[model samples]
Target: MSKIKISNAVKKYGSNTVISGLNLDIRDGELFTLLGPSGCGKTTLLRMIAGFNSIEGGDFYFNERRINDIDPSRRNIGMVFQNYAIFPHMTVRQNVEFGLKNRKIPKSQVTAEAQRFLKLMQIDQYADRLPENLSGGQQQRVALARALAIRPDVLLMDEPLSNLDAKLRLEMRQAIRDIQKEVGITTVYVTHDQEEAMSISDTIAVMKDGVIQHLGTPKDIYQRPRNLFVATFIGRTNVLEGEYRDGKLRLDQGYLLQNGMWDKIGDQPLKVSVRPEEIVIADGETGLRGTVLDSIYLGLNTHYIIRLSGGEKIELIQESTMEELIPAGTAVNLMVKKEKINLFTGDGSRNLLRGEAS
Candidate 1:
């Protein structure tokens, strides 16, 4: 395992800069994920670390050794592309052995190492089958086996599960995490799927427009987002615009939020982000009043769309337990969980609840 460091790394095409000056440090044996939407520079950053793209500026280091000038072949990094990249003409065993063979290990040791990883990837039963005969998951496993056969210093994956069906993607993601842990390799994964990154990564960097917006553990990123974008991007949130004045938040609908609410906020107009599951709805005279606009029954939860008295719309998710669904046009009282609410200034740059003890 190697500690990868990138300082002020920059990538540009002609005069257009795709990756601005960025700095990051990935620890040894850590499963770090770069997560963002399309064209957000996640893949570009991964490619730079893989030595596939030239670094226009800044330093790239592996284990304290400068590797900016090192070739991709000499970097000893294992890359699993989105397409799996399995050789079609070879059997599974042959494909896995290809990397070891290219490195010119002893013929006896090559087969042993290849077989070890094949079994590790749990595709040993189909070792003799060709790629054409394998399913998508099997092909992905073969690709992983091949990448690990060489025992690389770092493993980089580019949305490796995006091609598989939903069930297969889940299965393979778990398998990938298991294999990575068993081998104890430092891995960098790139994906746009928030849930997938949260499920597998030791650390995640949420990027936008060639820069990192948030960096934290999955729980930190999800439960206490630092900014409005991170809160909305990582999960479902209802952002309400309100005015803060003299220890009270006056909603546009004329509701005065005073007691039993988080009011220790700056004296400014701000937006409140409440997760759908954290908002409570019930039959009560107290709490903010709203009219249910719509309700959809999902298998695990029932989602409701409610319009506040001030005409602002918000969503609430309740666990599916009761048989009768709360129909639209029903008047309901809403209360946001005090600890679960996140406050952001009007510009949406900072979370006001960060320093306060919940």
Candidate 2:
């Protein structure tokens, strides 16, 4: 395993600067994920680390060694491409053995090492099968085995599960995490899928347009997002515009913030984000009044779209444990858990609820 340090890294194509002066440090044996939408330069950064792309400026280091000019083949990194780039003519064992042979390992040890990773990836039985004959998931396993057979210093994956079916994606993600833990290789994963990154990453860097918007654990990113973009992009949230006054937040829809909900006080407009599950649909006449606009049954939960008296829409997710459904057009009182709300400046420059709890 190796620690990756990128300082003031820049990538440009002529006049277009895709990544601008980015700095990051990935710990040894850590599974770090670069997550963002398309065109956000997450993949660009990953490729730069793998030596597939050149850095316009700045230093890229593995441990204490500077590898800015090293060739990709000599970088000692194993990369798993999105398409599972396995040789169609080579059988699973042969494909895994190719890298060992390229490094000129003895013929006797090549088969043993190849079989080891193949078994680790649970594809030992299919070692003799060609890539064309295997399923997509199986093919992906072969790709992983081949990458691991080299016992690289770092492992890089670029949306490795994007090609599989949904169920297969889940299975492969678990398998990948297990294999990565067992091998303890420093991994850098790039993906646009938020759930995938949250599930498998030790640390996640949410990027946008070429900049990192937020970097933290999955729980921190989801529950205490630092900006409106991070809050909305990471998960489903209800953002209500309101004003901070004295010590309370006064919503435009007439819902006043409970006392001591936040520590800071300002008189500027702010946005409050409440997760769907954090909202409670009150039974009596104690909360803000709203009418149910829509209700969707999703097996595990019932999602309701509630339009407040001021015509603002808020979604509430109710667990289906009781199986009681509220019909549309029904009047309801909505109350949000004050402590669970996230407050951000209207321009999304700061998070007011960053370190304070109710």
Candidate 3:
């Protein structure tokens, strides 16, 4: 296994820079994920680590060894592509054994290693089947088995589950997590799916335009996003306008909230990020008044769309109750979980909370 470290990484296409002076450290045996939208440089960064793309500047290391100029084949790394790139004419066993043989392992040892990984991936039953005869999930298993067969020091997967069905994606993600833990290999996973990154990673780096916006555990990124882009990207949130003055925040709908920003001098326009689950039906008249526009029952919770008196719409999630649903046009007062909601300046660039990162 290897602990990968990258510092001042730069990737440029002529005058256009994709990645600039990026630094990342992935712990040994940990599943670290690079997550972002398409064209955000997640895959570019992955290819750089794999040595497929030349590093324009900076350093790449695998446990004290600089690999910027090392040929990809000599990096001692295994890669799984988005498409199952297994050999079409090869049987499952043959595909898994191909890597072992290429490494010049003894034929006897190669066979033993192939069988071990086949059983470990639970694809031993399909060992004799050709690629065309296997299901997508099974084919993915074969690809995984082949990658792991060589006992690589680092494993890199780029959108490994994108082509699978939703159910298969869930199942395969769990399977990958289990196998990675069992093998204890340092892994770098790249994906654009927020939920997948949240469920599968030990640490997540939320990227934008080749820069990492936030780096932390899944819960930390979700609950305390560094800025407005991350707050809106990681999940659903309602952005509401308010004004901060004299330690009190006045919402557009006339609801006043007392805050602890005692050092402020003059009134400042505020942008607040309130997640659906953090807003609830107020118990009294002191909350923002709104009229429900719609409600949808979703078993455990009911989602409500309300139009505030100021004409802005916001969503709220409430626990389902045995009583009848709140019909549209009903007047309601809303309250937010002050500690859970995020507050930003009017431009939505930096968070107002002192400890929250930008």
Candidate 4:
């Protein structure tokens, strides 16, 4: 196991900056994920760590040793790419043992090690099958086995399961986490899939505009987002436009909300974020009173779109399997949980709910 440290990292192309003054410490043997949208510099940072992209500034360290000048081969890091880089002519066992062959390990020991990881990846049954003959899930297992065959200090995966179908993605996610834990390898995964990162990672780093907005556990990143981009991007959210008037929050349509506790926010126009799951839609709730515009049933739950009296749209999720449901144009009470309310300024930088009890 090895801890990875990125110190004051900066990456630039010509005059364009990709990453700016980033600092993070990844604990040994923990699954840390870099999560963001396209062009957010996540892949750039990952490539820098893999020595595929040279850093314009800052140092990269593995444990106590700095590897800025070290070659990629000497970094002792394993990487699995999005495209399963399996050779068409090679069988599953042969592909998994390719790294061992390059290092010129004994033939007998190589087979033994390949079998070991094949079993670990649960692909030992497909050892003799060619890449073309195996399923997508099976091929991914072989790719993982190939990476793990060399037993590198850290494993880096770049959207390895993105190509798989939905059901296969879920299965692969579990398999990846299971093998990662079984091997106890320090892993860093880069993906734009928030659900994937949240489901498998010990901690996630949320990035935007080439800068890290926040880095914390999955729950912290999801439930208590630091900025507007993160709050809106991580999941479905309801952003209410309001201003603090004498400490009380008032919506755009003269509707007032109790905010005597929000002292730090003296009198600023604040945009509050509430998840669809946080707002309670019942018969006589406070806050925004809205009329249902549409309600769509989704297997285990139903989603409701509310057109607020202030003309703002709010989403509500109900887990009930009740067939008798609310319809369009029906008025429903909207109540946002004070504990789940995430308040931010118009710029979406300041977290107004930081000091208050919830």
Q: How far is candidate 3 from the true structure (C-alpha RMSD, Å)?
A: 1.9
User: Weakest 10 consecutive residues, lDDT, candidate 3?
Assistant: 258-267
Best by TM-score: 2
231-319 per-residue lDDT for model 4 (tens digits): 99898899888788786877746766775557667788888888999877766655568899998888888899989987888889979
The 0-to-1 C-alpha lDDT of every candidate, in the order given, reads 0.90, 0.90, 0.91, 0.88
lDDT of each residue in 211-237, candidate 1, tens digit only: 998888999999888899999999799
lDDT of 3 by residue, 247-333 (tens): 777886678877565245247998888999999897778788899999999999999999999999999998999999999999998
Full candidate order by lDDT, most accurate first: 3, 2, 1, 4
Model 4 earns a TM-score of 0.95
Q: Give the TM-score of candidate 3.
A: 0.95
- Which residues of candidate 1, in runs, are more than 4 Å off? 256-264, 356-358
Over 4 Å off in model 3, which ranges?
A: 259-267, 354-358
TM-score of each: 0.96, 0.97, 0.95, 0.95
Output the better candidate (1/3) by lDDT: 3
- Candidate 3, after superposition: displacement of residue 55 in Å? 1.2
Candidate 2 residue runs with Cα over 4 Å from true position: 259-261, 356-358
Worst 10 residues of 2 by lDDT: 258-267
lDDT (Cα) of model 2? 0.90
- Output the lDDT of residue 198, model 4: 87
Number of clashes found in candidate 1? 1
lDDT of the structure predicted as candidate 1: 0.90
